[model samples]
Target: MVTVKMLKPYYIKADDNYVRVILAYQYFAVFINNKVYQFVPIESKEIRINRRTKKVENLGARFAFQKGKDIIYMAMSELISLPDFLVQLHSIADPYYLNKEIKSEPNYESEAIIDELEQLNMKRLIDKALDNRDYEAFQSLVKLL
Candidate 1:
């Protein structure tokens, strides 16, 4: 079962093999396997990643990123928090990105690509969700689409 934990994966280091998650607003304590790691809020919209291809052995329980730290390198990527909310809003949106992650491809039950020929007014759906206070639905669509 996949669920949004209100945490957004802001960065991933292939060399270091660490996934940095940042909270949208408050500092959330991520409890993974009994260890609690604090996530300082992310102010920037860009995804920051380390470019140096170096091996890091200490894949520890705690990783805290804050302001004033020097950015080694960054990828031109963007993702927002509240992903599950977005999914609930887009009833006819195609979920290509979500299906790509499934090990068992052709997750037919979930990922049926909606007809792109019919213009999906993404911005309108988003605005309506915001107005209706349907954040959960909005978040779901945001993560996959």
Candidate 2:
């Protein structure tokens, strides 16, 4: 039976020899398990209805990235608290060219290429995101396309 679980957001320091999986929004390093998997965003739109008020309201988007055949789905919102090194690398800082510096670092180039190819079909990906009610993802696709 396939097991599902949430992966706490973790960062692998520069000295670590783990595989880094880069995505459009964020990146992660799988240190313990050298596993092949894909993360599928679960719902993009989260609607909540008050029982007493009987009114439906849009809650901030709730999403989880379902991982691999094991089917673990980690909530993206829960990961929001984690620092995004990629973003931070590109952002203004004393080491103004940190982004460029990190480019030379060890990245799973093959996996990165695979991710790019998977996302090559912008229209199809956008359609899927739309179907999931993920407007943010849809907008990102628009910019990418």
Cα lDDT for residue 89, candidate 2 = 25
> What tens digits encode model 1's per-residue C-alpha lDDT throughout 6-60?
3443432232332222234333333333444344533333222222322122232
Model 2 residue 100 lDDT score: 26
Off by over 4 Å in 2: 1-37, 45-60, 85-145
Backbone clashes in candidate 1 total 17
Compare the candidates by TM-score and give the number of the best one.
2
Worst ten in a row by lDDT for model 2 = 12-21
Show how many residue pairs clash in every candidate, following the order shown: 17, 0
The residue pairs in collision within model 2 are none
Candidate RMSDs in order: 24.8, 28.1
- Give Cα-based local distance difference scores for all models: 0.36, 0.41
